[model samples]
Target: MMNTWITASAVAVIAGVTGFFAVLRGSTFAAHAIPNGAFAGAAGASLLGINVIWGLAVFAVAGALGIGALGRRARHDVVTALALVLMLGLGALFVSVSTEYADETYSLLFGEVFGVSGAEVLPIAGLGIASIAVIGAVFRRLMLASAMPEVADARGVSTRSLEVYFLVVMALATSMTVPVVGALLMFSLMIGPAAAARSFTGRPGLAMALSVAIALVTVWAGIALSYRTNWPLGFYVGVMGAGFFLLGRCWAAVRQRRAVASPLPVLPNESGYLPGLIALPCRRPCCAGRSAVPAVLLCRPLCPARASAQPAAPAAPDNFPQKTAAGLLMARRGESSVCDDETSDVWPQLWPGSRRTRCDGFRLHRRR
Candidate 1:
């Protein structure tokens, strides 16, 4: 039981960390397929009378390279699916031909966490450490590549090389985790906790911490529950991981709703420019004598009472028609020449003591 706990926890940590990048890189399907491919390696190892771990490592690394090569031509999901189907077919063939210890193959497909011994612990820990070190070394490059490949490429980062390196690291981690979690449930550990953590937080560091914590808790609790209830450990782990993901989705939904209800403040600079109130160049002849008055005033809404209080002014002649805000031309006597009712009062405020006359349009009148 102690050995089982140690192995499961170590595998959980590796999967949690690797899964963060898997989700970030949108290579979750590849994460799933790699473990199953490694499972095929285990089957082949059994048939060939070799150490299963070596077989798992070889096949996983090969599959990673194969996927990377294929990804250059096709979509990632398509490449991953092709690899997954091919590996599953190979695993089925290897299993069919092997007659001895057929029941043991079931254990490999599911898991044998309780069967883990002290001898296996050192290797598992070493592999887990190696995986973590590799991830740490390429963390920045991986993040830059995942977020914006074009930008990373422009900045002299070899995105393709980084991608292949990342995939190789994931392959190694998958190989180590398969024996403990089973190839079938390996993706659950690799994707579920990290996906849930991502939903709960936008910050990458905090999300990674949450992912590791969630995976640890899920593994420990699953082992305890399986021990007490006499159920399969994989079943408990899968259920717990899926439940956490659903809970995270619910939390994220609540946050989105709250954000929509109370949006962030919009600064003056952020506000859209008003199309009706454009500041034109001040070069009109009408504005020559008056420096205080602008050349063109795109009038907005003004007080209605001010519009009514102002004395009526004579309109311009037929030859010199004035354009109003409403696109109407006024050529009548003693009628307001302003186009829109909203800006009618504002024009009087701008041109104080200026009256519309028949001879000179609007001339400024001096107070007697």
Candidate 2:
């Protein structure tokens, strides 16, 4: 039982780190392919009466290097498709021919941590430690490359070599984890926490830290739940991880909404009447297509027809068609920068037909 906990922990940590790089670099499908390739290799080894670990590691590494040879973006989907086909096809073939060890093969696919012994745990533990160290040493470079690949390359970082290195590390981690968590579940362990963490923070470092913490908790909780309820450990771990990710997304969304709703200070010399812009808490539905602003306002009170008859005059700073004032207002409120395109929509709705006269050629309008 203790061995079960240790093995699960090792698998979780290895997977979490690999997943962090995978998601960061947008190589998730490539990382996923390694385990599928390993499945094919493990099945083939079983048919030949060989060590399944050797087969899994051999094939997974081959697949990783093959992807590296093919180039990163172009061959990613192709490699994943091939891996899936090989895994399922070889798995079926192995089952049909091996009547004697059918249960053992299935156990290998989904995992049997209860069968892990102290001796078997040592090798996997070593692999896990080595993977963690390599990940740490390359952490900054990987994050830099992931977020800004072109900038990183311009600054003398070898993006291609780093990609290859990341894939190799991912393959090794996948190979080590397959026997403990199975191919299908291994990827969930790898990607779920990282994905969940992303929902909580835009900062990659914070997300990675959150991912590692989530992985640890899920592993321990899965073991405890499985032991108490006689459930499969991998299934429980996956469920808990997914649930955590959903919770993170919900939390992030709530924070974003709050940020948007908070009041912001208007800049001096900025006019109160921002032109043709939509205000917050608007009922108007926004979409890809154009929609007319049914109502409009100008600081001046005049009859609708007179307002329409008057020459389209330069409007107040905020009331102008120019998006600068609204952008500044949003920035002062501590929210994410609002896109000019969105401000464009709001501008027409709020000011109507104001034009900018003197202020850096910014145009403003009042409702016609």
Tens digit per residue, CA lDDT, model 2, 1-368: 87877877888878778887787677788777788667777877877989888888888887788788776656677866776576657767776777665666666666777778888787788888999899889887776566545435644789889888888889988876787678767777878898877776655556677888888888888878888998887798779878987987687656544442111122222232222122211111111001111111222211222224343422333433222334334322322122234343344433434332222333223222
How many clashes show up per model?
2, 24
Error at 330, model 1, angstroms? 48
Worst 10 residues of 1 by lDDT: 286-295
Model 1, 1-368: lDDT tens digits are 88888888888888899988898788988888888788888889989999888889988998999999999998988989988888878888888899664677677767888888899888888888888899889776776567545445654789898999999899988776677668766678878899898877765667778898999999899889989998988898889889999998898666644432111112112122121112121122222111111112321112122223333423222222133221211211223344333334344544444344332333222211
**Candidate achieving the largest lDDT:** 1
